[model samples]
Target: MAEFRCRACGQEGTWVYDPERYTCPACGSIDVHFVVFRHELPDDDPAAKRMDELATEEANKRPKKESED
Candidate 1:
């Protein structure tokens, strides 16, 4: 079991899937990334969900890039 998030919509979900072929559950987009949680707990564990939220917060806080000439 593994958790995944959609890059396009920030949608989070879980699936027992191949990383190469996984798609976002919310929008059916292939633009997604894995979110590692715990090895002992299932993908839907509350802790995992919380961790995903924190990760998203951190990403949102990152500085934006300047435009190149």
Candidate 2:
């Protein structure tokens, strides 16, 4: 399972895969975004170190863009 947030209503929680459709459970909004639940960097792992550097500090805190009318 992965976490997701409803961009329209600011609801955040874990989500299971649904083959039928993807919609926010809070307000039934299709506009939603993913959330990373964990981040770890192992000293003995080179790949983990590289991933830590590549990951954005504000990946989850980014402001949503306004939709054009």
TM-scores, in order shown?
A: 0.38, 0.43
Model 2, clash count?
0
Candidate number with greatest lDDT: 1
Q: Write candidate 1's Cα lDDT for 1-69 as tens digits.
A: 778889989988777655345578678788988764356455676765777788789989987778756
State candidate 1's TM-score.
0.38
Task: Give the clash count for each candidate.
Answer: 0, 0
- Candidate 1 clashing pairs? none
Q: At residue 6, give the lDDT of candidate 1.
A: 92
Write model 2 residue lDDT over 1-69, tens digit each, in one string: 557789899999887634344678678899987543334323545544655656655555677668857
RMSD of each predicted structure: 11.8, 12.7
The clash tally of candidate 1 reads 0
What residue runs in model 2 are displaced by over 4 Å at the alpha carbon?
35-69
Cα lDDT over the full model 1: 0.71
The local lDDT score (0 to 100) that residue 27 gets in candidate 1 is 80
